[model samples]
Target: MPTSSSSPPTDSPTTGGHRFHALRVVIPALIILVWLAGAGIGGPYFGKVSEVSSNDSTAFLPTSAEATTVQNRLPDFLGEDAIPAIVLITSQQKLDSADLADIRTLAQDLAGLPEVAGAVSPPIPSEDGLAVQIFVPLDADSEVDAAVEALRAELAATLPGGLTSYVTGPAGFAGDLVEAFGGIDGLLLLVAVIAVFLILVVVYRSPLLPIIVLVTSTFALCVALLTVWWLAKAGIVLLSGQTQGILFILVIGAATDYALLYVSRYRETLRDHDTRWAATKAAWRGSIAAITASGGTVIAGLLCLLLSDLQSNRSLGPIASIGIVFAMASALTLLPSLLMAFGRSAFWPRRPQPIGDDVDPQVAHLPARGVWARLPRYVARHARPIWIVVTLALLAGTLGLTQLEAKGVPQSDLVLGSSEARDGQAALGQHFPGGSGSPAYVIADEGELQDVTDALLGTEGVASVAVTAADSPSGTAPVTADGVQPIGPPGTPAPDPTVDDGDVLLQATLAYPADSAAAEDVIRQLRSDLGDRAAIGGPTATDLDSNNASIRDRTLIIPIVLLVILVILMLLLRAVVAPVLLIGTVVLSFAATLGISALVFDHVFDLPGADPAVPLFGFVFLVALGIDYNIFLMTRVREEALHHGAREGMNRGLAITGGVITSAGLVLAATFAALAVIPIMFLLQLAFIVAFGVLIDTLLVRSVLVPALGHELGRHLWWPSRRIAAASDPAPAAVRADTADR
Candidate 1:
C-alpha cells in the first residue's frame, strides 16, 4: 500500500494529543452508551408486540374483494359480528340421554362465559348418535386464543368421562394461529441468535467476535421492534405475528451480514495501521458503500409490498424496511463503536498480524492458502466450461418448479405440527356438515334476497342456507327457494329477515370443509351466478380473497422489485451488463431454491401446500440478499480492475472478497433457518427457500459462476463505464508480476 505519511495521522491514537485522544475515547463511549440505552428501552417491547398485533386473516384481506364488502355489511344485519366455535363431543359408543344432558350443561356454562357472544346454540346430535355438537358464538373483538383456552379448560374440567371434545371453527382456527405464533417473541429470537452465534464462532474462531456481532444484531432488532410496536399501537400500520417474526430474522441476518463486511475490512486495515482510530476510519470508509447499498436494495424490495391490497403485505413492507434501516444503522454505527472500544483484542488469540508501514494494502487481501485462492485460478482457465456447467445445473434445479403449488394452504395447515383446530375440524367434518360452524355470509338487497338465497341454495357445495333473523329463537331462520321457513305450528308466521340500509344478510353453510378448495370453488361459482345480485363473505371467502390478493401482489411486485434492484445495481456499479448478468444468475438460483424446496415440501414433509405469500417473501429476501455477495465481489473487482487489468482484477477480487462474502451468506442463511422453529408453514417454507438460496448464491454462483463469467467477459463486463473500459487492456509487466506473486 502507498503511504501518504511516514507516521500516523494527528487524529489517530498514537499521534494525537491528550485532548484529541480523550475525544476519540469519549466519542466511542458515547456511541456505545446511546445504543445501550436504546436497546435497554426497546427490549421490553418484544413481549408487548402481541398487544398490537393481530393474526386475523379477514382483517388483512383486500378491501375491494367481495368478501370484504360482505364482511363490512354483516354487523349491520347480524347485530354485533361474532366468530363461531364448534364444540365437538364424541364417544366410542352412541351417546345416551345422560351424556347429552351433560354436554348441554357444558354448553350452558360456555355460554355464560364473558368470551361467548349473544347466545350459544343447543346441542345437536349426529345421525350416528355418537357425537353432539354445540355452536358457540365467540366475541370477535376479544382475545380468541384465550377464550378458546378457557372453553377448552372448562370442557376438560366439567365434561363427563368417555367423551372427547375439540373446539374447531373460524374462532378455533384463529386461536390455533395465535398459539402457533406464540413462539415468535421468545423462542424464535433465541433460536435465531443462537444459530447465528454458533456460525459466527466457527467462522471467526474467536469467542468475543460472535458476541459482538450478535450484540449489534440484537440491538438493531430491539430498536426496530420498539418503532414498529408504537406505529402499530397508533394504528399507523398493521402488525401481525408473521410480520414480526420476519422483522426479527431480517434485522439479525441483515445487521450481521453488514457487520461481517465491516469486520473483514477492519481486519485488513488493522494489519497496516498502527492505531485503532486509523483502522476504524479506513474500514468504515471501505465497507459503508456496499453495506448501505445492500440494505437499500432490501428496503426497496420490501417496500414494494405497499402496493399490495392485503393489509398484512402492505404492513410488512414498511415494518421490514424499518428493520433493514436499523440493521444498517447498527452495523455502520454501533458495531464500529464496539470494535473501536475493544480494539484488536476482540479477535483474541487469532488476532491479525500487523505488517507495519511496509505492508502493501493491495496485496494484503490475497489469501495465502484457501479454496477461494485456488478457485479463482480454476475459473480464469475454465471460464466458459465452468459457467456453462453451473448454469445447466441451476437450470436443472428449476425443473421441479413445476411441482410447486403456492395457491394457499388451508387455515388448518397454517400451523405446522399438531393442531387441535385441525383435529377438531376433521372430527366436526366426520360428524356434521363440514361447514357447520363457519358459514358463508352473503349480502344482498331485500329485493334480491330471494334471488340470492335461491342461487346460494342451488350452489353445488352449499349444504344449508339461512337469513339473519333478529326475531327468531335462534339468531338465524332457515331459508330455501320457498323463502323463510315457518318457526312453529302451521298457524305461526315466519320470522322477518333482518334488513339494514336496504340490504339483507344470508348465511350459506358449505357442504365441503370451510377452508377447502372445494369451498373456495363454491364461493367462486356463486359469485359468477349471482354477479352484482349479492356479495359472498365468510372465513373461506376471506382466505380466498387473501390468496387472490397475494397472487396479484406477487405478480405486480416481482417485476417492480427486479427493476428496482437492477437500476440500483446499474447506479452502484456504473455498468449495465454486469448488473443484468448478476441479476440473471441470482434469479436462476432463486428458482432452483424454490424448485428443490417444492420437492422437499411435497415428498419429504408432505405439506398440503404453501401460502401464496411464500414465493413473494422468498423472492424479496433471496434476490435482494443474494445480490449482496455480487456487490461485495464486483465492487472490489472494479476497484482492482482500475489498476490490475480485467483478468487480473477478476481473479484478485474473487480470491479476496470470497471469504467475507461466504461468511456473510452463512450467517444470513443460518439466521433465516431459525425461522423454522416457529411452527408456521409460511415461515418454514420461507426459511428453507432463503437459507438454501443463500448458500447457492455464496458457494456456487458468486464463488464460481459469476467469476467465470466475469473472467470470460473481461473488461467488457464494465461496458459503458469509461474508467473500467480503459483499464480492461493489458497491465504493465510489474503489475502482472505482482499479481502473479500473490
Candidate 2:
C-alpha cells in the first residue's frame, strides 16, 4: 500500500527537526530571490539580439560547399564585399532628353552616399525606352538596412516628377529580410506571453497561480537569452531571427509545461498533507523524474542537430539545448520555491481541503467523478476496439502525407506579408534579363576561364556572361563566344581578366528571376557541367545549396534523433516494450500531423510550398514533445503498478494524470501557435504542425490509444521487467461492472 509521509516533528529539538524546518524556509526564499535577480539582469538582453544575430544565408553554408568557396573569393574579384542594389526608374512614356539628364543626376547623387561602394553605374536605358536601370553597390560590412533606407529616401526625394524609382537586388532583398525580422524580439515575445497567460489563467482558474507559472517561464527565457547572447557574441554559435524566435518559444512553452506538471503534483500533495513544506517535498519528489526525463529527452533530440552539415542547423542544437536546461532548472527549482511560498493559497478561491488520514489513497489522490475518471472506465470496457479504431484513423490521416511538398520555398516567399523585394524582383524581371543585378558567379583556373565562359553561354538559361577585369571602368569585361569584349568605342582593346592564385571569376546572367525555380534549375545544370573544375554561387546558388544542405540534415538527423530518444525512453521506463510503444505512437502522431498540415497548406492556405527544414524541425519538436505526455502518464502508471496490480494501476494512472497532462499539452500548443503571428512562412508552418500535433497527442494518443493498448496487454506491457507481475487471469466481473458504471 502507498502511504503519505509527513514532515519531521518540529517540536523535538534533540532530533534536529528544528534545523531541518529552518533550512526549508531559508532555502526556498533564497532560491526565489536568486531567480528574481537573474530575471532582472537577463530581461534586457532580448532587445539586443540583433547586435549578435545574422540572417545572411551565405554565412550558414558548409565550408566545403562550392557556394562558400565562391562567396569567399568574391571580394578579391569585385574589389569590395558589396551587395548590389538595382534602382529601377520608370516613366509612363519614352524618356525625353530632360528626363534622361535628371536620371543621370540622380545616379551621380546616389554614388555620393557613404554606404555606396566604388562607383554607381551610369543609367542604362531599357529596350522599350520607357525605363532606365542603375546598378548601385552597397558595402556589405555597413548597416545594409539603413543604407538601403537612405538610398530609398534619396531616390524618393530627388526623382523627377514623371519618374518612379525602386531599390531592388541583393542589398534590397537583405534589407527586406532585416525589416521582416525586426519584430521578433518585441512582438513575438509579447504575443507568446499573453497567449500563455490567458491559457494558464483558464487552466488554473486562479489569478496567482497563472502569474507564478508565467514568471517561471519568463525567467527561464530571460536567462536563456542572456546565455545565448554571450555565446553568439563570443562567436561560438550563429544566431538568426529564426533561431531566436524558436528559442524564445521553446523556452517559454517547455518551462510552462514542466511547471504545470509540478503544480499538479504539488496541488495533489497539498490535499493529503497539512504542512506546506511537507507537501512541497512530496510534490518535488513525485514530479522530478518525469520533468527531468522529459527535459533530457528534448535536449538530446535537439543536440542531434550538432551532426548537421549546415551551420544554421548545428547552431540551433546547442542554443536550444541551453534553453531547455534553464527551462528544466526553473521548473524544478524556481517554480517549487514560488509554489512553496504561496502554498494552497496559490489556488485562491478553489483551494483544496486537506483529506483525513483514513481516506482512501486512490480516492484522495485521483479524481473519482471527472471526465478523466470516466475515460479510463470507457477504455477498460472497449480497450481493443478503441486502439484499433484510433490506430486506423491515424493511419488514414497519413495518406495526406503524400501531398506534402517540402522541396523548399523561394526566398521571395519566405516573408508572409507584402514584400518590397519580391515586388521589385518581379518588376526587374519584366524590364531586364530576369536574373539582372543578381548573377551566378563562377571561379575557375585562368586557363579554363574561356572554356567555363563557353560552357556558361551554351547553358539554356544563360542570357549573358562577363569576366571580372581590374582595369575595366565597370569592373567587368563582357564575355562572348569570341572571348572578352571591349568596353569603349568599336576596335577598343579588351581589358585583361583579373587573376588571383591563377583563378578567374566569370559572372553569368540568367534569363529567369534569380529567386525563381528556372534560375535554380540553371544553377543546377551549371554545377553538373562544371563539377569540381569551377565553383558557382550567388543568391540563387545560395538558395540551392541551403535547400540541399537542409535536405541532407533532415535525412541524417531524423533517424539519429529517433534513436537517441528511444534510448532515453528505454532507460527512463526501465522496460523495452513501453518505450517502443510510446515511440511508435509519437511517430504515428507526427506523420498524421504532417499529412494534415500538408492538406491544409496546399488546399486551405494556398501556400507556395514549404522549406526543406520544415519537416525536420516538425519531426524533432513533435516527436520529442509528443512523447512528453506519454512519459508523464506511463511514469505515474508504473508507480501505481508497483502498489496495485497492473490493471488497476493503469486505470488509476490515467485518471490522475489525464487532467494535468492535457492542461500541459494545451499550454504548449497555445505557446507554439502564438508563433503564427510572426508572419514568417517557416515559423507559421512549424507552428501549425506542432500545435496541432500536440493536441492530437494529448487528447487522442495519450488519453485514448496508449492507455487502451496498455489495458488490453495488462502486465505484458512491462514484459521482461520482474517489477510488474504478469497477470494471466481475467479481471474480476465486479471490477468490470463497477468500472462500466463509473
Q: What is the TM-score of each candidate against the true structure?
A: 0.96, 0.96
Per-residue C-alpha lDDT of model 2 across residues 1-742, encoded as one tens digit per residue? 2223344312111234777878877998999989989899999998788889888889999887888989998998888778899999888899988999989998999999999987788888888888888999998888778889999999999998977788888888888888878878888888889988988889889999999999999999988899999999999999998899899999999999999999999888777666677778889999999999999999999999999999999999999999999999999999999988887788988986676557776678877687986888888888888999999999999999999999988888888888777887888777889998899999999999889999999999999999999888778899999989999999999999999999999999999988888999999999999888899999899989889999999999999999999999889888888899999999998999899999999999899889999999999999998988999999999998877767777888999999989998998898899888887899999999999999999999999999888987788788767787445224645446767665
Show model 2 residue runs off by greater than 4 Å: 1-19, 725-735
Error of 2 at 92 (Å): 2.2
By TM-score, how accurate is candidate 2? 0.96
lDDT of 2: 0.88
Please write out the lDDT profile of model 1 over residues 327-414, one tens digit for every residue. 9999999999999888888888687656655666666779878798687877776778899999999999999999999999888888
Q: Report how far off residue 585 is in candidate 2 (Å).
A: 0.7
Error of 1 at 362 (Å): 3.6
CA lDDT scores, all candidates in order? 0.88, 0.88
Clashes of 2: 0
